[model samples]
Target: MAVTPGEETLGSRYRSLRDLVLEELRDQIIERRLAPGERLVERDLAEVLDVSRIVVREAIQQLAAEGMVTVLPRRGAQVAALDPDSALHLFEVRIGLESMAATAAAERRTDVDLARLDRLIVEAQEATRAGDRKRATHLNMEFHEAVVDAAGNPLLGSIFRSLSGRALQLFRIGQDVDAHGLHHEHVELVAVLRAGDAERAGAMMAEHIAGSREGTIERVRQLVAEAEAREARG
Candidate 1:
């Protein structure tokens, strides 16, 4: 529960303490700086962030509602563990939403959007080549998110925000997945986006997501089994 640098800077800039706390806590969970199933003590996090317990509790509750945190009767609130069923359900929703996002992005994307995509693709390639799975996974999440933002569909972005945390957690669990293949698919998606072929972009996004499912489901199952085994041991 260590406070990262620049948080005090954020406090100064943001007028809403609760919003800031929510953002920070959510980022920690998504980034796995806060590990899955780890207890989130309000007193501890509140002291760390120099905020009130009310604020931290509010943030945790919001995360709970988003399914990023789980609250048990006696266990309090801990980071949520990903289950294979949740991943499969999430894949179904992402397939529909992200494919729509790609199609809309292809129609609405500007030169600025393309520039950001190009930069991310290059960085992702570098991370993959270096075998930096953590950074590569983060960049992969960023790439899809950028396309959603570029789509100019506020509702779509809202839905993505709701799911992005668990989606990131799932990606992290797939650390052993082929990084090069993921980056290659990203490049292919960008090519379609660059050409503004809406239908092709949509189909490409669907296929890209399906490929990720294929690569990642086994790892998801493995993690689930490991977690269950650990619980059994206890």
Candidate 2:
């Protein structure tokens, strides 16, 4: 939905304002433009986004509900931190959901769906080779969503998408890693699915996700320690 001028100015159009704010914030969060645990001053965000305080508050509350932001008593809101424990917990949940989805998709795979997945895999590889991290990440998401869609389970797909958003946030906070390795994993996953090996495909999917979680957690821990030392020295 388009943001109306009146809604933008008055911030009374809760639905549109809420969605717009979320979209903007989601991009920032995913890109790590707004780093984890960074304070989100409503006044600063309102001024920067050209929205009202009401809109900012509503948007932040929605993000909090999504587990993307945290609201603290007397301290206001900040981007949610990606601690090691939380990362492991979220990845465990994701591995279970995605592995099941991959198994179901292998069993229910259609020729058309396979073709689309192949195309996405190729696109992701090309993006990675060209050093376009944003496009690569976008295609990575599309490939996974395609698998979930092929599973023909709307509930499962919805859950995967939500969890994937959180995972993407964790991924972004880590240093820029080349997508080439992940692209190869995607290719192998497609091969397993095409061969109709549900068990093997599920195992591969789980392993791939687990590897990503491990890499991201390690990076986050390093960054956290560096930040702490910097603060101590100051």
Candidate 3:
């Protein structure tokens, strides 16, 4: 039997709602509203978000696949804790991937792409100046994503997006180190891209990513040490 238009519309609406919920939940996690190791209760979340449990379940499943959440048998879902080893591994891959993206973007970017990149840089700078760490982090992702999108390779875009969830945690932590400096780095990278020097752009991006990884790992080590101190005191 052919599916009716009404059925398709209803399904579309449901999927849209699910996506909105998913995005909101992801933001909450990234901003630490839902902290690492925090348990998520479906009924509570569904009620709070004014959605059905099914929608919450589907959204959580997607987040899990993205490495933002961990679903354990019998224990349900919780935000994934940041692990230094995993973070290092992720950044190792990102350094290579993002350098390739920078090269492609330098070669392929159009005037429209440059305009978008400029706007995002301005927005990111404003967010940092306003001391809005969460917004700054969100804009940081947008700026990098804009660069990757300009690369014009569907497979590259897919791989970049896949790494984004885990990287969000690192970005959030790295902000405590220097949000201002990070925005400054973005500005410098934009200049390199505008100059259309693919080799320089790629090298700069690789170094930028490596620096971020080091900062995130340093923060993680401090956090672990603090936790250990509290345990020893107890």
Candidate 4:
């Protein structure tokens, strides 16, 4: 059968549905609702998400491509086990990217950019003080996004956005550690940005990202230990 122009085909609709399912599943994985090494059954996820098994299968394939899930021929799929070495590499990339962004922003940021950053800081502070870890984490991303935007480099922004999903997963893993402490760090970064010191701002950004890397690595180790302990008991 020939499809008419401007009409959405079944394939397109299914692809769209699959993307939604993929996003939801990624959220669960990042939020630890689907913990590391946990099995992912297509039927079970399909039932829970109220979607078809086909969509779940497609979504799982996408997740596997993103390095978030592992699919075995006989074992089906499971959330990828935590790899501290890979996490360290990603954090290193982030440090380089964010530091460059901060440096560029210091040189290029306008009054409006500074104002927006100030507002974000205040809102993030409120979220932290109110004990809203989720909102605070979101605001933290927004704050870095604003910095990158201020840099006014489309290519830099594109690269940062590409790495953000895994970065966000790390954020969610460490969300409970110290919202207030992180907010204060943001305050420091803002001050450097406000001073328009390119070198200092870049250094601050690198140091800030480096600070979080250890915590995330520790969390990964803890998860692995817990899993191992469970296996030993079993």
Candidate 5:
């Protein structure tokens, strides 16, 4: 069945305008084009996307449910701000879920799954080498998501997807400073997964996520300090 541009088949009908809008907004958030605390005005978005206000509202609500935005009583929706505590909390939960998923994936991975992950990791490495931070970050996400899918656990996979959405915002911000280091971490993770050592793979996944969280916190703190210093000088 051929899928139309706006209309997918019955099996894929869920990929509607709302999903499209959500992805567009998500990309903005990930690239920091829509910075934290930026208000998402429904009328503005509708005009920007050439979609109806209903579509914009639904997309904003989905983002809000994913913790990427907050809908205030009268102030409307705005991008959620990241802080050290929230970053740490998200990583703590993600570490447990992702580590277990990687372990299970390693134990049950098929050749096809392994090949896909390898391709993703290689693409990420190439992107990093080319200084394509956005592409590198996206491929890095795809690699981990492929691992979760290989685990063959729907519930766990859903949780990982949700966490990844939130984490990607902070991850992108941190990538401005540590893109190369993050690329190295992806290389190490792929190596562990390919080795089929579930225990070691799981441990490596946990450590990688935790290290990212710590690095993000430190970077945010540094930013805060610099801003404060500038304020004091003024």
Candidate 6:
């Protein structure tokens, strides 16, 4: 049973043009087609995306609200700068939310949840083995979202959804991580989750997320400076 992710496109059956444009812009940023700190010129984007400037503006505003885009004093909109304070805050919320979600998932998860977790891990591990950190990272985030879904709380799911894009950006900044270690930890988490040990699941999730904190701020500082330098050279 193959899942068709469906034909999602600007010209396809999205609810609105804004929604399509928003996703297109987001994908570009995440894929580095739109680099960090790069200005998002509305007219250029509109022309490239073959949409109206108003649609691009609306999409940019939504991204601003999501913290994926920032409006500078002199600049209109750019991909959000890699700020250390914001990264730390993101981890704080992620650790707390994911810890709680894992705990609840351990207690409430259905067999379906277990199946989904297993599948995500398999795909993620395969991606890791293939040296496709980008795909692995995407799957890893999906793994977290699956845990939140298994938590059986709609509000938690929504909050996690809102934070995921920002989280993905940070993960991209740190994707040069130990792929094998990540796969091993994910394997362990699934085992604990399957065993329904709420306390263990919560602790493991916190520790796993916190693993990224060591030197991450410094790395982000280096990466941001490098990106700024690149922009300057252009």
Per-prediction TM-score? 0.84, 0.84, 0.86, 0.80, 0.84, 0.87
Candidate 5 lDDT at 57 equals 92
Native-referenced Cα lDDT, model 3 = 0.82
lDDT of 3 by residue, 41-102 (tens): 88878766667889889999999999989999999999887678888888898899989999
Best by TM-score: 6
Measured by lDDT, the strongest candidate is 6
> How close to the true structure is residue 230 of candidate 6, measured as C-alpha lDDT?
82
For model 2 the TM-score comes to 0.84
Error of 3 at 223 (Å): 3.1
lDDT by candidate, in order shown: 0.85, 0.80, 0.82, 0.82, 0.78, 0.85
Task: Note each model's CA RMSD in angstroms.
Answer: 3.0, 4.6, 7.0, 7.0, 6.1, 5.0
Per-residue C-alpha lDDT of model 6 across residues 130-218, encoded as one tens digit per residue: 98888888998899999999999999999999898888877777887777788789899989999999999999999999998756767
Q: Which tens-of-lDDT digit does each residue in 1-234 have in candidate 1?
A: 644655454446557988888888877876668877889999888777778899889999989988999999988999988677888898889999999999999999999999999999999888888888778888989999999998999999999989887788777776666777777888888889989999999999998887778557777788678878898999
Which parts of model 6 have CA positions greater than 4 angstroms off?
A: 1-9, 12-16, 72-74, 228-234
Taking all chains together, the TM-score of candidate 3 against the true structure is 0.86
Residue-pair clashes per candidate, as listed?
Answer: 0, 0, 0, 0, 0, 0
- Model 1 lowest lDDT segment of ten: 2-11
Candidate no. 1 TM-score: 0.84
| Tens digit per residue, CA lDDT, model 5, 136-223 | 7787778878989988899998888877788777777677656667767777777777778999989988988887676788876775
Q: After superposition, how far is residue 157 of candidate 6 from its true place, in Å?
A: 1.3
